[model samples]
Target: MFTINNLLDIMVLVIFMNMQEKLTILADSAKYDASCSSSGSALKRHGDIGNTAYSGICHSFASDGRCISLLKILMTNCCIFDCKYCLNRKSNNIKRALFTPEEICEITINFYRRNYIEGLFLSSGIIKSPDYTMNLMIETISLLRHKYKFGGYIHAKAIPGASTYLLNKLGNLVDRLSANIELPTENGLKLLAPNKDTNKITKIMEYIKENKSQTFVPAGQSTQMIIGATKETDYEIMKRSSEMYHNYSLKRVFYSAYIPVNKDNLLPSLNLPPLKRENRLYQADWLMRFYHFKVNDLLNADNPNFNLLLDPKADWALRHLEEFPKEINTCSYNDLLKIPGIGVTSAKRIISSRKYFKISFNDLQKMGIVLKRAKYFIVCDGKYFVNNLCFNRSFIESNLVLEDNLLTSLKGEQLSLF
Candidate 1:
């Protein structure tokens, strides 16, 4: 009953099936890497295929909250290491795929022409050795740059313990380079991912900084740490992060919430990833980098965990009430930033405009300050705006969470003052 037409259809279907399977396995394997931010480059393009400038690349987040849309994939998932936390670890019976250098180049070009992706985030599971794997990566990126003339953004991962020669080679060819820190502390590494160590990771980071003049890495270097996989406290993890930034000059440290892929007795038994913890860390990180907050300012030995209900800044403001009720009109720029509702923009605006006139409560609202939380921490023209509202921490915390018709209530408070 079979005919030549039916035979053609079957062969075509088989090809699609095979490619689909490879894409599925490799893409799923890549989800564990949490180092995918691509916004740090400043390269301009003339007539190149794409640019990492103005419209460099726009990021789209996956369902689980990792950045996607850069053709994020691994060169191969057939890793030699048997790190129990990894799904692609050896000894696990799973289908594997490897994209030849030619195939990878063609896929990148095709995707770019179709506007499907603006760049590539190429990572790989170790095939032979770290140097061998790094060379394979170098070849793919080299082909994309030289042969295909790809001028778009690229985020390359530096294999830990790879030869410095190979690492420097790839660094010249990519916009961003990252080596995963894997775990925050040394004890965490020994317990969960025994094959990895922080010493090797830090050495690579140190090397990149030393060789930046010779290598490109224009976007600077970054690293990643898995949260909640071990017993390290948030304080400990952030303290290490702070050290890395000051010591190694890292641009960013990405925190990925741990998802238990395999049941190892050494791992925590969780039904879902700790996304909230990950988010709080990011908020705290932002405070550190931009808001001029020190790690000690955010967390200490006694208070290690972030409050789930309120953000770190709000929580800190609530605990350190003596620092609050700061006069908006005359407080120093540094003090203006400490209030929960006031951000960098609002703080700058207050500093700029207060020279002309005495700013009132309404002026703060117009400056994009979040008054719902700021009202508790700031005073306008020696007048407390939330004078009628409860000043206790519990009342403010509950009101902030419930929102509780608070904005309208505050408006009423304003009307009564007249």
Candidate 2:
């Protein structure tokens, strides 16, 4: 009762349904990774379909605060490794899906045409072996680049233990690449992910660093580390971050608060993700990256962890009271950055404005400085901004803590219906 055309149409419909199911499963699986932020690549080529400079891909954010400008997904959710912290581990009873190279290219081209995405962020769980998975990823990107002519921003995850040959091929095809270190400490990795090798991970990073030319990984490499899953201190984590920056030339080290996905005996029994700890680490990372603060300056063996009440800069300022009341007009640019409320922009503004005219306390406010926090630490025109200010550590500490609490309370308050 059916013609050949009728049977072919039915087959196409079934394939479309299957593709939709794969997308739903894989996209949800990819959400746990926070290292997919895209920037620093202005990749545009002749005869290409898209550009990274189109609409500022970094500006787009999902409702839950994750970057969603890219068609972020996995090649497959089937893995051979059974990591304790991973949701897609082999032992977990979750829905799995795989996208073939052609399917990935088709999806990316369609998404780009619809203006739903400006880029592609592709990662995967290990299938068969690391090399096999890397090969699949490479093939997908190759099809996107050559066949589809997708010149948009593409970020790919380099599988650790995959050969340098594949690593080089993948790096050349994508805008940026990341190889997640998984855990901060080697011991934590051993306890949580017994199959992963720290040496192999570093080797991938090393290879990327050594072979990086102008056309190869123009956005460079980044990595992610899980926090609160191990017993490592903040000092240890920052120390490793510093080393990676200097030793391997890493662009960023993203910190993900370990959200417990599996209930293994070794995993922590966390009721919720350690979001606050993760925030503090990001602040400290900013200090190390932009403010040029060393690990020892922010923390040490004596005071290893960050204070939950005070931010890293504020806590550091409180510890070194001798450096307080820094004359805003006379302090070095480096010292200007040490002030709690003054960020990189305001600090540069302070330096540039002072060259033309002496900056007053009123000018600081106009420059978008947080006067409440900065007032206690800075002086303008050789006079204290706060009249008759007490320099006592406890007094200043209590004031900053009170201000933070008030701000948080205000933010959490809901508007009443009249």
Candidate 3:
């Protein structure tokens, strides 16, 4: 004996409960993956509600210590692949749900209209198979692009085993695409995520690179590697990254510091919060991409890993003290690149500006080279800046330290937001 009003109320309550459940499962599952750069778009519809900013945005951080935005969710949480570290592994007992392509489109538009998000970031646990799962994601984007004509940003994961045709179809529809390089090496993949073939991931990245010239993946393809989970050394990671960049012509390679989400006897018992390792890798990555640093030039067997205390640039400067006092006027771009505080941007500015006038030490500072770190590395004419340190390489290395905890500063002080 229920009236229409009672039926409507019941439907509302059920929908609310379903949303709560979906939110918990999705946000929890997405905590591990950190390739969240949303900067690969050239499309601009005049008077459009959403605009893709190259600088990107950090909407918020979840409790598991990852940023959240764009209604980040999995179309389905029912994963078939059993990745040892993942909570959504096929064997794990977790509540799961699947959203239809239309469901996702509806949710995205509703969220956007309500000012809940800028767009959609859709990732999924492999349901049935990688190809099937990939197709579902593709359909979601297609619906958004063709039917809804959603000009808003869409970040979609290129499932490792997904077909090139599917990926190419996706390239035209979505803003940015990614194929997760979950681990540093094939051995790491074999151990942690056995079902995910490393070769397939590499092949997909290769395809993206080949097609980028003609069709283009606007934001370009990006990949993520989980650090500290496997035994892969930092040297090994950087070497692989260098190859990926050269071969794939990738826009970026992200490093996700390993946080042990599930209990496994094989995994480390010690909770190694990944922020420090993550930050150092980012600095090293910057050196590779912009500063023209080779992996071998930056790290090797003796220093198999980045120093947790100091940044890669500072660490490199401290180690190579003999190369210091590089003459500003005389040094080539290659030599300027070797200077600690001088990044690619500063080096170019200094080189370009010097042609007009003889740039002095003060002028070098004005050009954007961080004098604090650069002072010891470069000399203006005959004078040294940071060479005041009396210690040797190892001694200097021990002193140039950074803070351990980033989340505290990022969260409490809101430093990360800026």
Candidate 4:
């Protein structure tokens, strides 16, 4: 009773359903990677489909304070390695899917045309071999670039053991590239992810570092470390980050709070992910990157973990209170940044405004400084903002804690309709 047209319609429907299933599986599998944020690419071409000039193209934010929008998905969830931490490890019995180069292009083009996404964040689990997997990725992105002329941002993950030739080819085609470090220490890698070689990962980073030109990976590279998966402390993690930034010239180092995806004796049996620890690490990382703080300045063997009650900058200020009460009118720009409430922008405003006239406490407020914290640490026009302010550590700490709790309580309260 079925005609040729009806048969064709049924076949098309089946194909669409199959692709939808693949999209669901691959996208869900890709959620764990935190290094997918895009930025620093300015590639534009004449008569191209899209460009990366404005900011970045991903679902999350870039380090430059821009919201990046993209379709973040994995090329495939199939794997050849058996890492204990990975959900898609070959030993785990999970529904697997793979997308051909043509299918990937079709999805990307269709999605971009519909304004569903701005770009693509492509990653993969090892399929057959590292080189084989990387080659497939390169072909998919290459097809997007040449055939579709898609000039939008593309962030690709570099396979750990892929050859230099493939790496070079992939780097030239994508805006940003990342090779995840996975763990802070080589010992942790050996314990949790035996198949993943820390040496191979760093070698990939080194390759990118040495070969990066203006045209190749113009957005630069980033790496991610899984926190709380191993016993390594925050100090150890920061030290590794400092090393990567200095040695590899990385754009950013992302911190992922480990979620228990697989059950193994080697892994921690946590009821929930250590999200608070991750936030603290990010705060410490910001201080290191922007405020010119070293790992030793924040922590050492004596105090290896961040304080749960206070942020890294505030905690440091409390310990080093002798350096505080900085004069707003005369202090250096860097010194202004050391104040808890003064950010980079506010500090710049203070410097620029004070040149014209002496900055008062009201001017500090006008400059967008959080006087609640800065009041205890800074003075303006040779006068304390809070008269007879006690510089005692315990007194200042108790007040700061009370203010933080009040703010948190206010944030949690529901609005009343009068």
- C-alpha RMSD by candidate, in order: 7.5, 5.8, 5.9, 6.3
- Please give the CA lDDT of all the candidate structures: 0.79, 0.83, 0.74, 0.84
- lDDT digits (tens) for residues 1-418 of candidate 4: 2111223543453366588798988988987887545568876644257777555544545443334476788888878788999988878887777788898998988888776677899999887789988999999999999998898878899999999999999999998888999999999999988899899999999999998887898889999999999999999999999999999999999898899999999999999778768888988888989999999999999999999778789899999999978999999999999999778988888888888988888877777777878888887777876664577788889988888778768887322111
Residue pairs with backbone atoms closer than 3 Å in model 3 (clashes): 40-219, 375-386, 376-386
For candidate 3, give the lDDT of residue 43: 61
lDDT winner, 1 or 3 = 1
Error of 4 at 89 (Å): 0.5
Q: Residue 368 in model 3: shift from native, Å?
A: 5.4
Candidate scoring better on TM-score of 3 and 4 = 4
Model 3: per-residue Cα lDDT over 145-184, one tens digit each: 7777676778888888877788888877777777888899
Worst 10 residues of 3 by lDDT: 1-10
Candidate order (TM-score):
2, 4, 1, 3
**Rank order (by lDDT, best first):** 4, 2, 1, 3
Q: Which candidate is the best by TM-score?
A: 2
lDDT of 2 by residue, 1-418 (tens): 2111223543453366588798988898888778655677755665368877733565466766666778889887777787899988878877666788898999989888888887899999887789988998998999899989888889899988898899989999988888889898889999998889899999988888998776788788999999998889988998888888888899889888888888888988899787878888989999998998999999999899999789999999999989887999999999999999888988998898898888888888887777889888888988786564576788889999998889879888322110
